[model samples]
Target: EFFYENIQGGDFSQTKSFPGLSEHSSNFTLYYETDVWGARLSTVYRSDYITDGDGVSSDADEIGFHATTNVDFSAFYQVNENLKVTLEGINLTNVAEEQYNDSADRIYNVTTSGRTFYLGASYKF
Candidate 1:
C-alpha cells in the first residue's frame, strides 16, 4: 500500500516565536506484508517534508527543518493455536533532523527513540 498527503496553512504566530509558517508540506508512506513459512512479516517506509518558514525576520527565517526517510520492520509467528511470538523494530535508521528556534536563536536535533527493538509472546485462551 501507498499513501501521500499535503498540508497548506496561512501565516501564523507562536507564543514566543516569529510570525511565520510552513506554507506547504507533504508526507508519503509505503507498506508491504507477506506470509512465509507460517510467519508474517511487514515493513513500512515514510518520507517527510516541510517548506521553509516565511514572513519572519531574515535571521530567524534562515532556520529550517526537514526529515529523512524512516523505516520499520516487524514479524509475527504462531507457536501454537493458543500462543504466538512477535518482534518489532522501529526507526531502523536512527533518522533525525535539526530544528531551529527563532526566538531563542538556537538549533537542536530532534529524535524519537532512535533505532529500537522489541520482542514479546502472547497467549490466548
Candidate 2:
C-alpha cells in the first residue's frame, strides 16, 4: 500500500502560507506473505518545505526542512498456530534530520539517530 499527499500551501493575509506546509509527502510499502512467513519493507518521504511564511522579506520563521527519507523493514515467521518470531529494523539508513534558514543556507540545526533493530517471539494460548 502507498499513501500520498499533495496539499496547497496556506494563504496568510500578507504571505503565501505558513511553514512546514509541504506540497508532497508519501509513504510506500512492499509486502509478501505465505502460510508461515511474512515480510514488509517501507519508506517515508517528504519534500523540502518552509517552516514559517509569516514574513519572507529578510528571513522566515523556523526556516525550511530539506527533503528527507526513512526506510524500515520487518519480517515474521510462524512457528505454530499460536507461536511466532519477529525481527525488525528501523531507520535502516540513519537518515539525519536537517533544517535550514529561510534562505536555504547556513544550517539551523541537524540531528541524527542511529539505526535500531528488534528481535522477539510471541505465543498465545
Clashes of each: 0, 3
lDDT of 1: 0.50
lDDT (Cα, tens digit) per residue for candidate 2, span 10-121: 3423343345667789999999999899999999998878765444444443367788899999999999999999999999999988888655466889989889999999
What would the per-residue lDDT of candidate 1 be over residues 4-123, giving only the tens digit for each residue? Answer: 112123344332222233334344444444442133333333232223334245445334454355566777777677787888877777777656644343664575667888998889
Give the TM-score of each candidate: 0.52, 0.76
Candidate 1: how large is its RMSD?
A: 9.4
Which 10-residue span in candidate 1 carries the lowest summed lDDT? 1-10
lDDT score for residue 123 of model 2 = 97
